[model samples]
Target: MGLLPLNYRRPDHVSEEDVRRNESSVEFDEKADASLKSGYSGTSPGIPDALTFDRILNGGACPPCTVRDFMNYLIYIEHAAENLQFYLWYRDYVRRFDAAPASETVLSPDWTRAMEEDTIARVQKDATGKAKKDAPVARELFKGTDFEKAPEARVESRDPFATPPRSSAGDTASLSGSQATSYVSQAEDAFSAVGVKQPFTIQPFRSEINRVIATYIVDDSPRQLNLSSCEQKAVVRALSYTTHPSALRTLSQNIENTLRRQAHPNFIRWSICNGNPARVTFARGLGVGTILVAAVGSIILTLSKAGRGWRALFAILWVLGIATLVAAAKGMCVVLHGLHHRNVRPWELFVEDNTTGLEQLHEGKRSFDSFGSCNSYEDEPWVVKYQRRFYVRKVFDREVWIQEPALRQIQDTIFLQSVLLALFGASALTAIFVAVPAGGFF
Candidate 1:
């Protein structure tokens, strides 16, 4: 059977006073049998475990008797659970990796920035002084290097589409200088065809270039220091993996857990209440009005010589009134509940072990799959169709449903109650005066 909202206000047949009075009169065996029948094994039958019940009872404001209150309480619990889970995950992470200096240094942005600044300052101080002294000599030496010549002027061929000649099988450098130049021209032409105006060039030694400049200025060495493409890639890969065992997986799991916890409660609450103030107030009024109408109609029908059909109609009215009262008291929409079974989390499972709790909170693991799929009316099963049609309003092109204006909701409730009252009065009056005196069916 689906989980139903408990009516806390409704007293069981045996009240506290009655239980106290009958305590000594009842037999122990009878009491135990009664508990067993109610589905209780050890303590109170049908009641959750002591700790779980206590948590629910103390959860907040008696689970809210109205839709608006229920939704607000659910939202509060969800947000609180999420914040608590995040705090726990962070605390665990810090405790687990506290001894690792590299982890701490990598995680802290402030520490990383401070280390970078120190390295840059040391490099500049060592290189600047000698570079100023050897500026003229360094400039003269750089003139002879390839860096001083234009790329096109140095090439033997101006033709951009030229291809390299096939080399002899024994030649060690398969593509010689001329062939290499031809290949470079072809690549440049290809780049230009795709709208690139600059020549295609590979500079896989940015860090090496900086190091060489620093070395030339400080040590006054004419030798250039550079890493090949393969060497540069290897160095980069090594640097990236310096901090192994990434916290990404752990952090992602924590985030998923947080969302799961919030989603379950929110889905259950929405399924039951839908958080429409107008609808809640209207339902409450209709329930009360139905009961009052039933009472008046019953009295009139009893006093009159009404037919079997009229008597049966009164009976049906009484049943409808009672059912409406129950729904109103629980703040649940009967039509919605019938369509979608209640699949609220059990009281004990709310604080289940972290992993178990997270699994339960997950949408896929939910008993009612419709909650996961149909977030809005556009999706399947149409769970929220009625709510969307009546309660929602467009504000700035976005639909707003909850927290409608108090005056508007009140007005709607009053109109509904007035209509019910009018119907009840007319029916009662007609049955008593017109139908009774007619002497037959009518």
Candidate 2:
């Protein structure tokens, strides 16, 4: 028999304190019944006679369904209105089943064991381990496993009008470039006949948005760089087929337009933060570099026989470089921040580490993906209290975080500061060389 969640249990012939301790649970159950009566029901047609958040999250004890199965259903539904029903059920279920608004409902050992066993069983069943990351998109906040690195089992093509495959041995033959070009022209003509001129548009990015503007906008196109067409297509495809298709399309068009204006290896830098390139310059970097070099040169000149004007120049540059380094370390680019104040939020940035940072790398492995947090999620857990009772909010309790960019922004901010500090150190060394006499070393 399935074990009942703590909230569903009643105070048998136990002490009054036991009942009082669980008073919030009774209130929640009543609220849940009221919610069901007042037009709140699970997304399914026939509402289960008894419904609870535990059932919605980890599957019902009655039907014995896991939360994983429920999520899988949502994935299949995609954008169907019925999926919205499931979303509502989850929201209501959480509000009603929680023992207290603030107290974190720790998963019982049996429940945790069940989930772990289920995960392992599912993994073992899939020969390719593809199902491991096949999590439902909604409530992606719960962390059982990181599906980001799941096996590349492609989604079955749903388009009914896909082109038929042609083999060389069959009636179809491989077309030369010229032949392919001719066919494309014919297809274009046919498309024109049907009044369709490639359903696409280039969305322009206003250069005044963020430093991304300076990073991506110049006077030439990115296609002229050594990047392959395949890379472009990959970026385009990811942008097009995102969960937020419309937003991705808009972002991609904006990126494409931005690329037409400049070429920067660091284009992805600004792109990652949804920042503009035209506004960001090496100036932030240059400021710190100048200060470091000047300070170092000044010290060297004091020891040597350098001229006054040159010494003053070195000192000024050194001070400026030091200030810039400090600013970057603190993520303070006042001018750029003011210009793109609305677009850029003060948060951490998540950058992937391939290797060479930790023991994981020494073990011949690397992570192409990483995540960050506002406050340490691992350190301080969030709980919602209901009427002086405590309950863990499921959204914060689970390990996985679905709000990807928001958390990553915070991490990135921390990383950006570190990088600026390093840049300052390098600038100081360079200044010492340029301003100080080389004879001192001899």
Q: Lowest-scoring 10 consecutive residues by lDDT in candidate 2?
A: 366-375
lDDT of 1 at 138: 48
The regions of model 1 sitting more than 4 angstroms off are 1-275, 307-309, 341-442
Write model 1 residue lDDT over 412-439, tens digit each, in one string: 3323444454456546644554334333
Compare the candidates by lDDT and give the number of the best one: 1
Model 1 TM-score, 2 decimals: 0.27
Which residue pairs of candidate 1 clash? 40-45
lDDT by residue (233-318, candidate 2, tens digit) is: 22222222221222122223222222211211111122222222212234355665666556666666656655534554554455
TM-scores, all models, native as reference: 0.27, 0.23
Highest-scoring model, TM-score:
1
User: Model-by-model lDDT, in order?
Assistant: 0.34, 0.30
